[model samples]
Target: MSSYLIRNAQILGGAPQDILVDGGVIQQIGPGPTVEADIDIDATGLILLPGLVDLHTHLREPGKEDAETVLTGTQAAAKGGFTAVHAMANTTPVADNATVVEQVWQLGRDSGYCDVHPVGAVTVGLEGKELAELAAMHGSAAGVRVFSDDGKCVDDAVLMRAALEFAKSVDGVVAQHAQEPRLTEGAQMNEGTVSAELGLGGWPAVAEEAIIARDVLLAGHLGARLHVCHLSTVGSVRIVRWAKSQGWDVTAEVTPHHLLLTDEMVRSGDPVFKVNPPLRTETDVLALREALADGTIDAVATDHAPHPDADKDCAWAVAAMGMVGLETALSVVQQTMVDTGLMNWEGVADRMSHRPARIGRLTGQGRPIAVGEPANLVLFDPAHRSVVDAATFATRSRNTPFRGLELPGRVHATFLRGMPTVLAGELVDQGDLS
Candidate 1:
């Protein structure tokens, strides 16, 4: 790869400076550059941030390839300014074993789009009965440190406790889906007036809060780390805060959708608004935003779950419970956090890139833009605005809730190890990696 200089961009979360990249590392970042490069990007009005890292992304590969492959999902991730995304382990074969996890890791390496860290399944087939080979998966070629039963909840308290205890020895964290299955069975939307009026079974907030309350205490008891996924309720935020007050080793993430949209969108009867731990009330949305602002939430993750059109374009009760998030995560954050005065670009970097990287224990990622740091970077035009067009996305699925919605701050370019994965807001071709 040739050298490049990103000149005049406001380096978010860093002192004002210019950055020069050579040999896939940031070589110099200062006021004046005596060096020349093959390319020099004029970034006069843009903000430069570390390439985003997502701890929760569902790149459905090795099985649900029709919905998303590592290539397409990471391409979308690049478009959203991500340099790495931890791929969830909820595929058809279930990435519970070393072979499957390593295969997925190799595919991401071969795809050459973004760094893909495979998350191991917390339980065998996510059954919550038998523990998957936690130590083996952690020691696999994938070097998986994050384990989760994301699509299914680890509802059995005894099993959850055991998993937490086992993870403590390996220094791995267990991310829980945090839904009480018995309480949310057949539930179509958030448990509130809307669901009641729609005559749909409500998924009560207590269901999620109940599980989180249990897991944090379990983590405290076992001296293990815990991560809560896609926290969507106000009550859940209070529990996480209380856990932190007790100094429990717990971290939680909120989805971009939960931060911006609400269950009232479900009145459209559009499946796009349907998601797991379903969108809650406007009050819950405000609480999530405040939690994110006040540090009660650790990060903002794109639960970028993809599904085929047939699965998502159906009735609300039967529709899939996710949206394609990789392409819109940063834009939504820019709208909800930056533009709203709730956070600055530095806070955005911490939540979207730095903190998430730490959570997944990604060593080579989320570094500050400086000499000798890896050239994982993004040039963001905060003033830019556009409507989200799902048909134009790089992912195989078009299930985003933000379709036709106007969002701000487009990603101008994203560099992964000094190679342009996205240039001028468009995905560049990644040559075949044999």
Candidate 2:
């Protein structure tokens, strides 16, 4: 292992301090006399944070490798300053059982960029018909702790109840996509004044809010852990807040795209702006941000769905619904939350790192930057700004909605277990493309 000395970095935006990382752990932190190491970084104006964690990322490997692979997706995550991400189970083989989940988990281990915890599918084939082998996946080598049918909804009440029971039995959590299928049969974008003007099929906000309301009630009745994924509507936020007020075991996450983007982008007729529980109204965007800052929302997830150009670069009616987000999440958060004075660096660390890790039950990835703790860290220059260019990103896909938008902040370096996965804003040990 290599030793690193990061000099005069602001830890969690507190007083500047020198941090010494050795043997995969933080060895010392404070004003130091002088330290010798294999690498010395002059971090005079950088903010050092506990490495970011994503509770909801779509790494389309095993079957959709043309879109993304575990290796490339984790590389993108490192560039975004994430040390751990929970890979959503919405792939070709649909990681519902032990064997496939284990395959994805091993691929993450081999990637060496960041930690990837596989989320098992809540239903077989995500059809919402039969419950998948939840306990078996939890007992597998992958040790799956989060289950979700992300691209689809588990609308069957009896089946959802059983899944919740299974999660409660194993101390895991069931993450719901929160969309009522009947209400959103052919939804193209958010249902509102914009949709009316464009003459496109609209996805109603109640479709999401209704599912979240039912799931929150179910979780309260069962006393089981439940997590809402990609919450976008103002009504959903109010319901989640009410659920927390009642002391239910319910937690919710908002995506970085939802925090900043709106349905107004759909006016451009670009499929890149389309997403599941699609980009909402500006009012909903503001409400989601306030909820995230006030702790009504628990964490920030990337929902980092990737798709080939053939899938996305088409007519709106036939285009795929997603945007590549792993490489741009932190920058989006900084623009909408920190720079707008809605949140500080400490709140950013909690929402992006500590809380997401806790929701995923990950013990090693989100530890604080103190002596004897694992040195999973990110050094970010908040003063830096850049216009995004998807062509230069590490991910395989180029469907980012922020393609030419100027975003605040940049990741200088990211360390996973004291190893530099990204250094000086470039991927370390980038091997063959073939």
Model 2 lDDT tens row, 208-228: 999999999999999999999
TM-score of each: 0.98, 0.98
Overall lDDT per candidate, in order of appearance: 0.91, 0.93
- The lDDT, on a scale of 0 to 1, for candidate 2 is 0.93
Global lDDT of model 1: 0.91
Q: Pick the candidate with the highest lDDT.
A: 2
Residue 353: error of model 1 in Å? 0.9
For every model in order, what is the number of clashing pairs? Answer: 0, 0
